[model samples]
Target: MFIDRAVIEVRSGKGGDGAIAFRREKYVDKGGPSGGNGGRGASIYFRANSCINTLFNFRHGITIIGKDGEKGGTKLKYGKYAEDVYVDVPVGTVIYEEKDHKFIGDLNEDGKIVKVVKGGRGGKGNACFKSSTNRVPRIAENGEPGETKRIILELKLLADVGLVGFPSVGKSTLLSVVSAARPEIADYPFTTLIPNLGVVSSKGGESFVMADLPGLIKGAHLGKGLGLTFLRHIERCRLIVHVIDMGFSGRDPYQDYLDINNELKQYGFGLSDRKQILVASKMDEEGAEERLSEFKSKVNEEIIPISALTDDGIDLLIYKCVELLKTLPFFPLYDSEEEILDHKVYTLEDEEPEFYIKRPESHLFVITGDKIEKYYKMTNISTDEGMMKLITHLRKIGVDDELARMGAKDGDLVQLCDFEFEYFE
Candidate 1:
């Protein structure tokens, strides 16, 4: 039930259509245009909630849609704007666009909100186009279309310290003894399939969140034994508590320590460089002291020996974590400037072309672009005035000139989206 990743579809609401009406009062000699403008569409937003800990609510591949605006009323009344939609996700959730895998935003704190997609703008009424040169305009625009997108949500547990080691190494046992989290513990490997979180309060009144991640094997970086599924969870951890099983008869404690460090180095994300506190578990077991001595001799760093069952050295471990946390700063998930820039949104205003021209056939020319398509969708082409407006926009944007340069002749076909028309120069 602890789902951390999900793919969902989201859509924003469309604007309401404009109303075309005229005054027919008995006392009025000449009635003017009294059309009303359409209402605005709803926008979609994602909010972070501290009470939620997983992405399970969004695992069912649901499609979320925002509310549409109300239609415009008669007597020059403007339509009502739609209410925005908000989605609640767990803290530390990262969103990305599914099509190109572009990073949208990171919700790492509680109550943080991000607007993922914007709704379409409402169209104008015939009264909006009334001018002295062309009084009593009869054209009314249609409503704009909504935006649809498929996004991916990934959850990374936000913890001050992370418990990492091989399976059955006392990581979960230590967590249960120090905090209220009761993780499934067993004698076999991979007993803790999912990550577990607990809050540990030191004797000095200092508290910090700790996470017990799943076990890791030799080839973990190469997709062996849980693989990258759980390794990503370690990226946000500020401190790593490496627990080594000094009592395991078949395994060498020093070798285990070296192997786990190698996996962290290979996984990248600056995990190997992260601050660590070495813990030797099962100190009460027979022959554990001898192995601990050997591990201490091989490594110059200090290691704390603790027995979870007997509560020996647990206070020292907790105090050491709190002491070190005061000096250590939070590590960013993205370290390099290039990585940060890649996640940002940038606009290429003057560099990119407005539209592209493609000729699939000698008699047909296809025009495609984001701006052109948007205008085509919002224009009300049923009336002559609307059609003339679109034609004027196309000419102003150099579409007509470009077609003429391409040897387009009269009666030739021009395509924009699904609509096709004959060119007349």
Candidate 2:
């Protein structure tokens, strides 16, 4: 199965919680806080693998979670950091963020890697808070949560030349004769369902990759027939070999040429602008010469005549393709600068408040925000000193003032995530 696209869920590992402990060894007159910091979480990355040709393995939505870091220990024993996860995908695969449809990275080259999600940072231990004023601080932080995202992977075939035309126009036949590839071919239309790749070498030792792509119908650009399913494969082709059936299919060769080129123009992505070589295929058939002569009169460009079955004019076609490829420039599947600018950017000035107060019911207040939620998760409120330290930090951030502004009275109920507390002025 030639699976070109897939959607998968990926998650980074969570950091380990900081330990809150004090020295209790013998002969120790004064024992201060000795809690160690938590370990960092594992990150998720995507690497390119040249060996893989398809994304068939990732058909179902798979969640790739990184290993969680070990918890901190007493006596300043830091937790162990988890290893990062690296996923291997086919070369020329493009990754996109599913939610926003933003371009994440393109694995155009082998061994190319991009960080998909960053792991959460480890929390600080109580030892980090100890100072001249507070030597026996009891506060310890919990581990931070990792990032989760749904990403889409799309594979684009890398080929030097792409053969495109209506179905059964001798594309598969041409590929089979010119190279070692054995694509399924039959007399019926749409026989070549999947894109087939082959390597053709000239007599002068010049070689180039050629792809026998799926046929393009009139409404192919609008997703009719093979449609956009295989259109992406053509984007990488430096040269397009427009294979036309000369009076064989009883279809007008000129009209077929116009329809196919229109589809390319509609699809965009610089495909219509690429240099094309016109080929009047199946030249052995009767009336093929007359049709070719007429097609030459209507079309201003040069058209090569070839018969894949008899091996007539095949060698010259290969030589012509190799020569043309040398002068053609490489076409990129995506614009790097445009994709980079499309990604979300953040500035310090755009930062929101640490917490926001919401009154869902009378005598009830809710506080929520990124910074506040992180602090709330890290707070070890079981200890009185820890709870006081958290309260002091909340006050410093104007959470108390925000609550008062929202008509929060003394002794009222306040909620932070799942935790609830009695408000006090």
Model 1 per-residue lDDT tens digits across residues 1-425 = 66778999999988877767777789998888878888888889999999987898889989999877666666788778788899999989999999999778889878999998787677777778789987878777777878899999998878889999998998899999999999988889999888889999999999999999999989898989998888888999999999999886479999999999999999888999999999999999999999999888899998999999899999999999999999988776674433565344557764557788899999899999887888888888878888998899999999999999999999999999888899989
Candidate 2: where are CA atoms >4 Å away?
Answer: 24-29, 186-188, 204-207, 248-252, 326-330, 335-344, 347-364, 369-371, 396-398, 409-412
Colliding pairs, model 2: none
Residue 296 in candidate 2, Cα distance off native in Å: 3.4
* CA-lDDT, candidates in order: 0.88, 0.88
- The window of 10 residues in a row where model 1 has the poorest summed lDDT is 335-344
Tens-place lDDT per residue, model 2, 53-103, is: 889889997889998777788999898888999999999889999999978
For model 1, the superposed segments whose C-alpha errors exceed 4 Å read 21-30, 180-188, 199-208, 248-255, 285-294, 323-332, 336-352, 404-409
The TM-score obtained by model 1 is 0.85
